[model samples]
Target: MGLHPIHTSKSYHDKDELGPEGNEFTSREEVFDYDFYKKLASDPKVLAIGECGLDYYRLEPETAAKQKESFIAQIELALELGKPLMLHIRNAYGEALEILRARPGARGDVHFFAGTWDEAREFLDLGFTLSFTGVITFARDYDEIIRNTPLDMILSETDCPYVAPAPFRGKRNEPSYVSEVVKKIAEIKNLDFEICRTALLQNALSFANIH
Candidate 1:
């Protein structure tokens, strides 16, 4: 159980939780809360700037603009802080990539990627790592992408409390289940489990800039 927790923030709701009492909270300000995140990112243990990015899976048109505005702010903060980002892109991969492309030099991972190969390649070309969740265990759609991605550009996650891997499917997920994700990667890449394991650990450390 030797695991380093990477801190992450989202550019979205729960105004009551983070908002000042009785003041009207705007999505842009609340989502990007520069001062709040700057404080957190200053912590030595805090490794990244987000789980913040675009999520258009069920977005309303009005809120979409705010979401993009918030995302850009976080991206700017990531660049300013020199910390990597932990992106959460859902159905808006195209827009997300466009924004990230415009803002060069901010390193990040596209957590729980479920995009097409072309989109994946775009991110790879832009120097971002792609992380897979336990969904790969029960679904074959990601198998090709997993096999095609280079070892250095790949990482695994549990997305825990959701999407538990096979043999543990339909149950609550935990960090320990990430081994199944690594196992799937080994099978897809046709590499020995230990080698794949070592390489993935190295890739993760490198991506997060951990020594």
Candidate 2:
């Protein structure tokens, strides 16, 4: 069975309560509400707590502290609920690593990982799986990281509707297109396509604790 979870980023979502149509909103809260997250994450369908983390791509000093505040809340939420995390770290690996390192027994996958071998190594050392997207199918961006990462510790994804893989780069993306990402990973790791595919599936299952 294809068991997937309800994934989202509470860290980046606006603090204001969104309207029913999702366009209108209320005044932003001074303190972010972990209670709202706690209710949603308690749902059985929600397997992970994230797509959340630091993103210093824009480097707004004020937002950086806020981002860390939201990130740590989600991290604690994941740990409290006994669910895995799906991190969305970008241009702030060191900070992300520091936060995660302090929390013993935290486990998850770092989605769309775009970091150096050293950075990836630190995450791997924490027993977190590193996930790659269709970005690897075109640019040589993460080829070395893919080559160096162990097959079992790697996960393949498509980041659908964005970053379409090669041979279909200009078109819209979908979950089915993940096959190309898997194929590229197999090629990088020099393993049979089926072997890589199976290992990745196993990793996903293990990451979400779908025994």
Candidate 3:
């Protein structure tokens, strides 16, 4: 797997159920230890500071508030660490965008982005990139968005062991399936396959701040 660099992220989730499972569980307090994050973020191998953001898909109002607090704190950490944010937003783009917009200079990818072009534009305007998963292969819903997005602003991901692409739709997804995602982007944008592949590779490397 030397094909791509591995960039680990540290994030804070308010709910206990959402934290790490089993004996290795991370408590809410530990999630917000600025000094702990500073040490991890200081590591050159740990490229970014997230997969963290608002997820209002499920939660009570109080829990959602805590998620927001955690999200904002992680954003601060990314800014401090001078690394890009690896965001995971769902059913809460409006709230997420508000918090992201408040930060001004903050930048990162909206990983597995499944939002509208307008929402995507807002992220692009913030100087952030958008990464897509294997969903685009079977679903035509995202075609226009894929076509509309600037090539430099797009990257490929495989939110796997799930969202496996077509022809392997029901199986557990592996990183290799990301090539299918890349292929779909090329088809949607009507670009030559190699050009799309290289652009996406460079886009991911550049936006993720990997060497």
Candidate 4:
């Protein structure tokens, strides 16, 4: 069986009416739940402490500061708890890299990573893995990076209800489509599909330190 219940905490940005039964983080303190996340992540089943990181896409000065604060707080929590992070970075890899550099031994999977080779290498150097998403199925930008990234340092994700793979584009994504992502990775790396699939599963297990 594949990994399940991969719990994560707040991201830098969130949608309106975002959670079940209308429950949501209603304030800056609640949204950037550093203390709460540390407690949540301390659970043995909560393998990582994220879906959290910097997002400079809109680039608001005030919002960016809050994002940084939340990001760094989560980094500290993950480092202290000895848990891997599940990062969500966009247009902020350089800044994220600098922050990570300051925190040695901080390691995690860069979810839906679409960074340049130099950026990817910087994270890789810091022992982070680049997780590819359904974007690779429709875009060619990620091809070279996948080819260059070490198999053991690579991961697959659906990023579901968002970037659904080709042939499923415009449809809400589900975890079942992750196989398409692994197949694309296998194609890019010129490895057999099953071999690539097994390797990715093992990579996730090891990265999260799950037995």
lDDT of 3 at 191: 97
Residue 139 alpha-carbon offset, candidate 4, angstroms:
0.8
Predictions in order: lDDT: 0.78, 0.79, 0.76, 0.79
Ten-residue region with minimum lDDT total, candidate 1: 1-10
Clash pairs (backbone) in predicted model 3: 51-86
Each prediction's TM-score versus the true structure = 0.85, 0.85, 0.85, 0.85
- Backbone clashes in each candidate structure, one number apiece? 0, 0, 1, 0
What is the per-residue lDDT of model 2 for residues 1-211, given as tens digits with 9 covering 90 to 100?
Answer: 0011111222232324221213332223244468887988899888898777877754545767777887888888888999888888878999999999999888999988999999999999999999998888888988899999999899899887677788887677779999999999999889999999999999988887788
Which 10 consecutive residues of model 2 have the lowest summed lDDT? 1-10
Q: After best superposition, candidate 4 residue 132: deviation in angstroms?
A: 0.4
Model 3 quality (TM-score): 0.85
Where in model 1 is the C-alpha error above 4 Å? 1-29
Per-residue lDDT for 1-211 in model 3, tens only?
A: 0000011122333334232221232222323566777777788887788778766544454656667777888888888888888888877888889899899889888888988989988888999898898889998888888888899999899887667788787677889989999999999999999999999999988976777
Runs off by more than 4 Å, candidate 2: 1-31
**Which lDDT value does model 3 have at 115?**
88
lDDT, candidate 4, at 19: 19
> What tens-digit string does per-residue lDDT give for candidate 1 at 1-211?
0011111222343435322212333343344567776777788787887778876754665657767877788888888878888888878999999998899997889899999999999999999999998889889998888888899999999888677788897677889999999999999889999999999999899977888
